[model samples]
Target: MDLDAYVAAHLAEWRRLDELSRRRRLSGPESDELVERYQQVATHLSVVRTSAPDATLVAYLSTLLARARNRATGARTGTWRGVQRFFVDRFPGALYRLRWWWVGTLAANVVVTGVMIAWLLGHPAVEQSLLSPAEVDQLVSHDFEDYYSEYAASHFAAQVWVNNAWVAALCIALGVLGLPVIWLLFQNVANLAIIGSIMIRHDHGAHFFGLILPHGLLELTAVFVAGGTGLKLFWSWVEPGELTRTQSLAREGRTAGTIALGLIAVLLVSGIIEAFVTPSPLPTWARVSIGLIAEAVFFAYVFVLGRSAFGRGQTGDLDAALLEDRVATQA
Candidate 1:
């Protein structure tokens, strides 16, 4: 093909694309026309690359393609499809990748809590020092158990959801500092340990477990995930591997943010269970079993569904091409 003739033939279309790209405001017809012209120029650019490979033409088309791409992307509106992808792929994928971090945190926290409970149970004097005799008596006799039934279920569920979500958010937001994540988790574990010790010493260990297990299992798991994700974000820069520290932190931060949103739902479920199931008239076994079942479902979701998504290279982040510095990451 004669290069001159080819250029001349499509010169009008190229000019049209340039004009449309430069326009400040577009009518409906002009917007449609711009898209059409953009597609045509892309095809023209492809043909020039293969058939002619002229440097000048190639450069011009490349610039035009980029402009068109930005315009097209900018014009597109957000959709529910994006939200669906977030939950179906991004959220689960992030959860799976960070499972080890959160799981480890969870294990350590549980051990710490159990140790504290045991120590307090065995040493009445130690427990007495932590709270006054009258305070301990009040908690053991009423405050602990009545915590579940003090408010209406719906109100309690909303309250619990917001409070737990806030804690999870704090773990993620303050995760960059490293020590704060640990401190926040320590606060949580301390509460559970104190409550458990008091209840068990009063011969109400069964009641404590009964009230907690229904919501605590899943609820606590969500908290663990948040702490784990936060700590991982902190480490991303500390041990950035092949990536630059900036790149590593950016990637992990995006994933951690996604985990935060996902945990909102998990916490909400636990809140519902705490409000409805924990305080229900159901037998202790039945209540605890419900909690176990809910926890099992979450595990299956992460290990099975989440693992699959992660294996497929889903990182629970926006595409790298969307970010300026992510075009060619090292690791």
Candidate 2:
């Protein structure tokens, strides 16, 4: 192929694309022309790469196409509207669509925790084996309660937020494996069961509920959401249905990202409650009520905002334009 001759033939179209991309405003016809030129230049770049393999020409066309893409898509990165749309539409839409996964997770964990608590209460020997009498006394009397107030409130909230975020991230990050997510969730509830059992066995059941319920309600829910979303991702590849395995996994993985990002704020709220409200001087009823309200508000957000977004055909995935350029598939 004559590289110079090919460049000569398409140089005007490439230059036109550059000019359109640089313009602040484009007319109706100009916008259509810009898209047309972008596609042509993209094809030209593909040809140059495949046939001629001209490094300099490929670099220029690549940059030109990138600029044209940004201009054509309006490049919404880091914008307030983009953030708003994420929370209002994408995040909740994902939550609503995948509600059963997380909801089932939440229920199963609750049942397992409850059974473990019961078993521990009935089998006192197990508790004794895990913790000596003195250790159990300390946990029930001081350690459990002081854990909340041991750190300064603001510092504790930030610390808890980061830790919880890491855990949730792991759930999504390791979701593809299928077993790591369950292990994480199991370890989480097992710890809860052990503590609750010891506290209740020692006649401090009221104290246990008072401290934990204040934040545990929403905190555990966030964990469950993460666990469920991870499991869903695993299932995407396992049972991809009509879509190809790659497409199903990609769709679920992207939605998992949305849930992971959204869970940061959710976990932060729980952290704040855990740090401040759990150790506050307020009555147990009031603290528990605050936690209940937070939990309620989260559900309403999922059911209302998420439902609406899903009804509008939002799938929490990137827009079609952002996902891929409209390139012609050449044989």
Candidate 3:
């Protein structure tokens, strides 16, 4: 196709469509013309994409067509219904679809933390290298417990929420590179191992588990979910399978965003547990049970609601109509 000649032939019509789309109001005949021009330009875009494959021209026509489409249909805004659908369908569906990724992450981190704890216990000298005897004594007896109750519950909850949310966000945001997500997860588990090992070695194992399990179970799960989602996003482009790299990335990226949003609520619940339940006068069994129940509820949300949504073909992606049209081409 002679790109210049083709553009010259359609340039006038494209300009006309642009004008109609830009207008605040259109007469009946002009509305009809706008619809007609929209279809024509859409076809032109397809042709240019398939034959000429000019990036600049394809972008121009795509933008022009989008404007015309919005003008023709009128714009829409989010409603309560949309928000309801997101939680009921999109969020759960995403969680279901990406279950293995995060679940594996959670399992692996647990194992690594356990091994690290065992190694540290086996090698007592390692502890002295990290902290002095005075600091260790302070941490084991006071600092560890005081950290939770030092602040008001509400203030601590907010602080925990913000900090955890930032960590989760970083895992997802830097997930595309792959290594960063792994590193983040490692840092998380390493800290746990270090603290857990120290507590156990110093005969504070019960206290440590009592304090940690109350909130750590759910909180760490949320973090693992973010890490797994990030790893999946990285893999999407690396091994796209049937879809083009761009399509796969876009699809996974959208799902990751949904997961990110959903995790806010998850992390909030954990934050509340940590701030209130962890530091409360409740017994260890009671507090740990509460954590267990929260973790169970999360799993049920994924296995029940998420599985059902996925069965109904919800992919946690944008609705098809809302996604931009892609020109099909052979690899």
State which candidate, 2 or 3, has the greater TM-score: 2
List runs of model 1 lying over 4 Å from the truth. 1-77, 324-331
How high is the CA lDDT of each candidate model? 0.87, 0.91, 0.91
lDDT of each residue in 245-293, candidate 1, tens digit only: 9979988998998899899999999999999999999999999999999
Poorest lDDT segment (10 consecutive residues) of candidate 2:
322-331
Can you rank all candidates by TM-score, best first? 2, 3, 1
Q: After superposition, how far is residue 70 of candidate 3 from its true place, in Å?
A: 4.9
- The digit string of per-residue lDDT tens for model 2 on 199-258 reads 998899999999999899999999999999999999999999998898899889999999
Candidate 3: 10-residue stretch with minimal lDDT: 322-331
Q: What's the C-alpha lDDT at position 153 in model 3?
A: 98
